[model samples]
Target: MKKSILKWCMLAFLLISNLAVFAQGGTEDTPEPGDGTEPIDSKLIWLAIIGIAFAFLYFANKRKAVRA
Candidate 1:
């Protein structure tokens, strides 16, 4: 009976603490819209993805050859 009461007390404390955290607003130093940043090149991104795919295929074939 004591253990059950202790568990309920701990659970209620945790619930109240979480509600207090959620009630707060964001800080004053948060970033505003249109913060200056350049976009990345899509061609370079695609080239890196293709290179990774080729590497995976090469290793898979090498492993299969070793098994045979």
Candidate 2:
């Protein structure tokens, strides 16, 4: 039980730690990637990729659970 709790705590810490860096990135005055006129924004693409990866992990785990 302690090991399972520790594992979840570590996962939560890693996720929160990574997101904390994003919170430091931009202010309302300046914004990220400079002005609003940029043709391409990589952030959206990266967000989508992360979403897909999370979905994949969720589905894979769900399948394992269903089989067992």
Candidate 3:
């Protein structure tokens, strides 16, 4: 039980750190064609994606429990 909790904590930390690392916008002066100077906030999109992932995991676990 303790090991499982520790593993989950580690996983959460790693995932959050990774997302932070990637979320950093480019430091260059010139923006790409489609991309503008302003950063597009995708908080809603991220929430939706995370929600979907959790929903999938929840349903999958429920299915396995039903089978067992």
Candidate 4:
């Protein structure tokens, strides 16, 4: 039992130390308006939403049909 406890303590210490080493420093630069990034298309988002709604309705109808 004592050996198991020691092993867990060592593991926790290594994990915490590695987290500090991997931590990132702050960046100085920030983006401004019209940074030449293309705007996202709204049509694609609507298509995805409609497709998911249809899929859920299709599955629910199928389940209801099976029960009847």
Candidate 5:
């Protein structure tokens, strides 16, 4: 149980960090695309991908649980 809680805490920390980094928009390394002024935001795309992955996993687990 302690290990599980620790794992969840780490996962939450990583997710929050990723969100903050993504929210900050393009950095020096990323630079601006063609405009050279705007910072492109891609959090929505990231969110969509995460949502789809979560759904896939949920269904997969449900199926496994049903089978077992």
Candidate 6:
């Protein structure tokens, strides 16, 4: 019972700190990537490729485990 109460107190503390940070707003050094830089679409394509590769590897391993 004591442990559960401590866990909840910790969770509430974390939530309150997160809310405080959000209320402050705009913590970043640079305005979010819109200042005449190269477009992000190419970077997004690379990210998609990386995601697909990981998914393919995951399924391949699963298939091998099933076969074994």
Q: Identify the candidate with maximal TM-score.
A: 6
lDDT of every model, 2 decimals: 0.85, 0.84, 0.86, 0.87, 0.84, 0.87
The runs of at least 3 residues in candidate 4 whose Cα sits more than 4 Å from the true structure, single-residue gaps closed, are 30-68
Candidate 4 residue lDDT tens string, 1-68: 99999999999999999999998687686557578643457468888999999999999999999999
Candidate 3 residue spans exceeding 4 A from truth: 1-41
> Candidate 2: deviation at residue 12, Å?
28
lDDT of 6 by residue, 5-64 (tens): 999999999999989878845455655566775557869989999999999999999999
Query: Looking at candidate 6, what is the lDDT of residue 59?
Result: 100
lDDT of 5 by residue, 3-68 (tens): 999999999999999998888454456545676655337467888899999999999999999999
lDDT of 2 by residue, 1-68 (tens): 99999999999999999898767544466446756745456578988999999999999999999999
List TM-score per model, in order. Answer: 0.39, 0.41, 0.39, 0.40, 0.40, 0.43
Q: Which window of 10 residues has the lowest lDDT sum in candidate 3?
A: 33-42
As a TM-score, model 4 comes out at 0.40
Winner on lDDT between 3 and 4 is: 4
| Candidate 2 least-lDDT 10 residues | 23-32
**Model 3 accuracy (lDDT, Cα):** 0.86
Against the correct fold, how does model 6 do in TM-score? 0.43
Q: Which ten residues in a row have the lowest lDDT in candidate 6?
A: 24-33
Clashing pairs in 5: none
